[model samples]
Target: MSNTPIIEAIKLSKQFTKDGDFVLNSLSLSIPKNKFTAIIGYSGTGKSVFLRQVLGLDRATSGIVRVLGKELHNMEPAELNAFRKNLGVVFQDSALFDDQTVLENVCFPLKEHKRSMSEDKRKAIGSEKLKLSGLNEEHFNKFPEALSGGMKRRVALARALVLEPKILIYDEPTTGLDPVLKQKVDELILTTHKRRSSSTLVVTHDLPSALHFADHIVMLNAGAVLFEGSVSEFLKSSDNLVATFREQGLNKYGKN
Candidate 1:
C-alpha cells in the first residue's frame, strides 16, 4: 500500500444547533491507501458524523476534508457528484430500496453514473457483483422486503461493489448480525478488500471483529482521537481508554 492518504481530515469539527458543544471537535486523521482501518468509539461520539463529512454528505463546521486528493466541501455539486462515483458506501441500515428488485437495486449506481451503458450491460455488471457477494441468480428478482437481514446486507454490499470504487466505507456493518453471520460478514469484508484492493474504512464499535481484520485502528473518545496505531499496538497498548475498551470488548465478544 502507498503512503498517500485516500481520505484526509484536517481539524474537522461539527456542532448541532441544539448541542452546546462540538459533537466532533477539531480532529485530524488520515486513512491510508489500500488499507483497512476501523473507527471505534462509544455511542454518540460522532463516528457516523465523521463519516458523513468524509463522504461530503455533510459539511464540517470548521475544517477541511479531502478525499482522493480533492477537498470535498469545496467541490462544486457536479464535481462532487463525479468524484463520488469512485466511492462506495454501505450504510448501517443496508439502505436498499424496498420498491426495486434486487438486480435493479444492485445496478442503481451504475445506472445513475454510467448512463451510456446499455441496460443489459448494467445488469451483467450487477450480476457479477451479486455473485461475488455470495448471492445466487434466484435472489435477483426479489424485493428488499422479501429478503432476510443477512441477504439484504449482502445485496447492499453487492450494490456498493457495483461501482468498483477506489474506497469502500462501511458504517456499522455488523450491528444486528448473529455470531455466525457476523463471522461471515467479517470474512466477506476481508476477502472483498483483498480482491478489490480498495482503501476501506469500517466504522464500528465491534472491537473484537475490528481487531480480527483491520490493519490499523483509530479510537475516538468524546469526539477526539484517543488512539491510533496498528492492530497489535491497539491490542497491547496501556492507554486507559484503550485498556478499558479492550477489556469491555473482550468481555462482551470473548477473546478471539
Candidate 2:
C-alpha cells in the first residue's frame, strides 16, 4: 500500500428523489493508508450510501472520489473490477451462502476471480484464512446453517481476508453477537489490520467498538459530516450533540 491516503472524497454530494429531497450534500472525507477508520451516524443519514459511493457502486451527483489516486467515475469496467478486487466488504448478514459448506464459501472469491487455481490450493488457502480467524479445522465442512451467528460472521471475515485485500470495509460487524462474541469480533477487526496492514472502513453505531478499534471517527448527521476526530478528542468535547451521541451509543449496548 502507498504511504499516501488510500481513499478520499472531495466535496461529494448525492441526492435522492424521495419526495424531491436531498440526502447527502457537500460531504467530504479521507482515509489514510493502512489505518482503520470508523464511520457513525444517525439513522438514515446516508452512511451506507456514502460507503457505496466510495466503492463506486453509487455515483455522486457532484465532486470526485479517488481510490489509490484513481478517480472512481473514470475507471473502465475491467479497471473497475480490478480496482474492486483490492477491496473486501463484510456485510451485515455475513452474506454467507446457507447451502455451501464453510470451506466452499470461503473459497468462492478465489474461484470467482482466479478460476485456474487448483482445488487443493484453494482449499488450503481457505483453511489457513479460517484458522487466522480463530476457527478450527472442524468448521470446514459445516454449512452456514450449522454454525452459530458469531461463527458465521467469523467465517465471513475469513472469506474477506482470503484474497488478502488492500482495503477491508465492514458494516455493523457486531450486530447480533452476544457480548463475548462482540468482543471477539472487535479483536478480529484489530488483528486483521495489524496482520494484513490493510486500510479498514467500518460503518457502525457501536460506539465502544468504533472508539476502541478506530484511529479516527467521523460522525454523520442530517446526511453530512457533523464531526471528525480522534476518539479521545470526541469523548472530551463538551458539545451537546457529541455528548448525547456518545452517551446513548456507549450506554445502549451497556458499554463504556
Candidate 3:
C-alpha cells in the first residue's frame, strides 16, 4: 500500500566492538519493493544483527537504514518508537511470553500500536491471523510452554501480522522445526506475502525455503552482500563462490 521502497540500506555497517574488532563489516543491500527477499548466509555473519538494525532494535555505526524511506540510523527515542511500528520482526526465538496465552501474544502488537482498538476487536483479529498461520481455535488459550516449537512460531507469525505491518522480517522462520512443519512455515511465508502483498524480508539459512519462497535472494558474508539477484539468477550464477555457497559446498565464507 505504500509507494515507497519497503526497506533501504545504504552502505550499512555495524560493529559489535568485541575488543575493538568488528563483527559486522560494511553491509549494503536494498529489499525489493513488494516481494519476498531471502537473505541467506552462514552462521556468525551478522544476520540477526542486520535484522535488528533494520527493525530499529539496534543502531548502525556509520551507515544509513531507511524503512519506507524514513531514516532510522540516528532517530530519537520517540522517533524510533513511532518508526518501529511499521516493521514487524519475528525473532529466531519466537519471543513469546510463556506466561501469556497464545491469543494474548498475538494481540500484543495491536494493543501496543493501537491502544484505542477494543479488546474484542483485537482478539477477533488475532484469531483471524492465527488461523491464517494454520493455527486452530483450540491453540489460542494455551500458554507458550505447552505448544510445540512450530506452533510457537505460528503464534509469532500471528503476532507479527497483528499490526498489519508494511514489512515483516522473519529470522530463520524454519529453523529447528520438523521437516513437515518446516514446509508449513515455508508455505506460510509465501502465502503471507501472496495474501497481504506486504514487503517481506527473510533472514534465514534455510536454503531450500529461500530458493522456493524468495522472489529475490541476497547472499551475505561478514555483513557484505556477496550475491544479489533473483533466485534463478542465484542458481545459475557463474561465480564459483555463489555456486559453492548456494550448493552448500566447501566454501568457508571467510572472504566476503
> Is candidate 2 or 3 superior in TM-score?
2
Task: Rank all candidate structures by their lDDT, best first, as comma-separated numbers.
Answer: 1, 2, 3
TM-score leaderboard ranking: 1, 2, 3
* RMSD, every candidate, angstroms: 1.4, 1.9, 3.6
Q: How far is candidate 2 from the true structure (C-alpha RMSD, Å)?
A: 1.9
Better of 1 and 2 by lDDT: 1
Instruction: Name the regions of candidate 1 deviating beyond 4 angstroms.
Output: none
Separately for all candidates shown, the number of backbone clashes (residues 3 or more apart, or on different chains) is: 0, 0, 0
Candidate 3 lDDT over residue span 1-256, tens digit each:
5555677778887776746655557777778788889988888877888887877778887788788888886689888887777787788889998899999999988888889999999999999999999999998999999999999998999998888888899888888888899888888888899999878999887777677788989888877888888988988888877777766632332222
Candidate 1 per-residue lDDT over residues 25-102, each given as its tens digit: 988888888899999989988899999988899987898888888898888999899889888999988999989999
Superposed by TM-score, candidate 1 places the C-alpha of residue 148 at a distance from the truth, in angstroms, of 0.8
TM-score of each: 0.97, 0.92, 0.92
lDDT digits (tens) for residues 61-175 of candidate 2: 8888888788988888778877787888898899999889999999999998878999999999999999999999987999999889889889999999888888899988988
Error of 2 at 99 (Å): 3.4
Index of the highest-lDDT prediction: 1
